[model samples]
Target: MNIHLRLLLLAGAAIFFGYTLYYIRKKQLDLYHSIRWFVLSALILAMALFPELLTVLAHVAGIEIPSNLVFLIMIVYLMLTCLSLSASVSRQHARIRTLVQEAALMEKRICELERRIKASEENDDDIVAREAYKDKSR
Candidate 1:
């Protein structure tokens, strides 16, 4: 790579690394999510510092163009990230569904209890009124 490109990559990697750390410290990004960003930044820094490594990787992977290797790596990484995020979203959706079902069941139970309480109160009032009537008759 040219000197200008290398310098740009280095600066970009440094900025990305710093941004990742800042978000982690601020509690916006957790450790699990920050790991991928850290790795990505480190890889960029490595490639910028030693462009020869890319050539060697490309040769080993049987890719004629080193740039193509970079593209392939990025594509794979993005695919894995998307898969992980999708799985997480699915789990959250299931948990939310369970929570809604449980809430509905709880509401039903509460309504039933309230109805029973009202019926018991009415029965007690009738007994009290009947006793009062017998006492007056005596």
Candidate 2:
């Protein structure tokens, strides 16, 4: 491994690992989501420490270039991550829809109850006036 490449990988891994920890601590990122980034940073550190591993993996995978393999792995990871995010968003959409429906139903029930109460009060007032008028006439 060239000294420059090793240094770059080490720095990148350190930065990524630190940012992941910071976000998790601040509650800005969920632990579940951060786990992937942590693993990625660890892999980067491993590659920096042992660049030979990449060559071996490339040979085993029948790839001509190790760098291409790394890029391929990154693309695959990103695609899978995107799929996971899409599913999560879909689930939240469903939950929001359910909550909105429930709220609308609750509002409708409240309005109906209020209307019924108002009608009942009006009927009581009318009955009271009729009774008072009859007593006066008698």
Candidate 3:
């Protein structure tokens, strides 16, 4: 509602767009979904700057509203998007945990191999020493 808040929101929107574009170009972000997020972010930023835009649009679409319907719609969209993202994050986390478990098992196997090799070497040394002592006593 204030001038400073409006400017900050505008700056934030600019940064969001810039980041989205840079990420897209680098192939680090999803194309379709990122664009959807970008558009939603930009629209929300615009609406925040001038909330009357919502009223005007609603009126154009023959909707009478004294309440915050537009804000509710935006919130719902963000909620669904975030829910999907959270599910994806959860799946990735599960996969990473499985990979870590596998790596730990591999490391344990390597340690077991080293222990076996060392034990075999000690047994071989003991046999050689006993044979040498017998020959010396003869």
Candidate 4:
């Protein structure tokens, strides 16, 4: 890689590392989720520090273009990240469905109890009225 590209990559990696740490400290990102980002930043730093590593890896993998190899790695990383996010979203959806169902059931139960209490109160009022009527007749 060119000197300028290396420097840029180093700066970008450092910034990403700092931002990842900040997010973790602020509780904006889950620790588990941040792990991948940390690893990615570290990988970027390593690549920036040692551009020859990519060349060697590309040659070993039979890849002609080092830049294309970098792109391939990035594409794989993105796909994995997407898969992780999709799984998380699906899990959240299932949890939300369960919570909603539980809430609906609780609400139904509450309404049923409220109706029973109201009926009981009405019966008590009727008994009081009957007692008063008897006393007046006497």
Candidate 5:
């Protein structure tokens, strides 16, 4: 890689690393999710510092172009990230459905209790009125 490009990659990797740490510290990014980002930035820093490493990796992987290897790695990383996110979304969806069902059940129980309370109050009023009527008749 050219000197300018390497320097750019180095700066980008450093910035990414810093941002990841910042987010983690702020609690915006959890350790589990930030791990991949840390690995990515580290890889970029490594490739920038030692351009020959990419060539060696590409050769070992039977890739003619080092850039192509980088592209492949990025693609695989994105695919895995998407898969993980999809799984997380699926779990959240299931949890939300369960929560909605439980909330509905609780609401139904509350309404039933309210109805019973109203009925009990009305029955007490009738008994009081009947006793007052008998006392007045006496």
Candidate 6:
């Protein structure tokens, strides 16, 4: 690789290593997210490091020589990242729905118990009234 490419590769490696160390120390980001960040960063940096390859790819895709290859690659990379994020969001949404259903069911059970207690209290009052009437009759 050329001197500039070598420098870019070194920078990419440094980012990956530094980020890994930071994550290990902080325990903030998940493995998947970190890996994704590493891969995307490397892809972008590598592309910058090798502009000629991009020119050739753009040509194959019928894009003009001076076309916006960088933009095209960025668009594709963004699409992939969005897809992954969408899947993660969908899973979390399903989990939230399940939790909501469980909470609703528990609330319903509590209401049912409250109603039963009220009914029992009413029955007890009726019994007391009847007993008082019998005592008066006696």
The per-residue C-alpha lDDT of model 6 at residue 38 equals 73
For all predicted structures, in order, the TM-scores are 0.80, 0.83, 0.58, 0.87, 0.84, 0.57
Clash pairs, model 5 backbone: none
**How would you encode candidate 5's per-residue C-alpha lDDT over 5-118 as one tens digit per residue?**
689878989998999999999999989989989998998888889989888999999999787776787789789989999998999999999999999999999999999999
User: Which one wins by TM-score: 3 or 5?
Assistant: 5
Q: Write the number of the candidate with greater TM-score, choosing between 3 and 4.
A: 4
Lowest summed-lDDT stretch of 10 residues in model 1?
Answer: 1-10
Give lDDT tens digits, candidate 2, residues 26-133: 999999899989988998888789878988998999998777776777788779989999999999999999999999999999999999999999999999999999
Candidate with better TM-score, 4 vs 6: 4
lDDT (10s digit) by residue, model 6, range 24-44: 569888876788767766776
Rate residue 89 of model 3 by lDDT: 93
Query: With candidate 1 superimposed using the best TM-score fit, by how many Å does residue 61's alpha carbon deviate from the native?
Result: 1.8
User: C-alpha displacement of 76 in model 4, angstroms?
Assistant: 0.8
* Segments of candidate 2 deviating more than 4 angstroms: 128-138
- Better model by lDDT, 3 or 6? 3
Q: Which stretches in model 4 have alpha-carbon errors above 4 Å?
A: none
Q: Between which residue pairs do clashes occur in model 4?
A: none
Each model's Cα RMSD = 2.3, 2.2, 5.4, 1.8, 2.0, 5.2
Q: Estimate candidate 1's alpha-carbon lDDT, on a 0 to 1 scale.
A: 0.90
Q: Report the lDDT of model 1 for residue 120.
A: 100
lDDT of 6: 0.78
lDDT per residue as tens, model 3, 1-138:
345645765776788788888899999998966877698767758766786776787777676761255656677888988998899899999999999999999999999999999999999999999999999999
Kindly list the per-residue Cα lDDT of model 4 for residues 27-71, writing each as its tens digit.
999999999999989988888888899999999999997767777
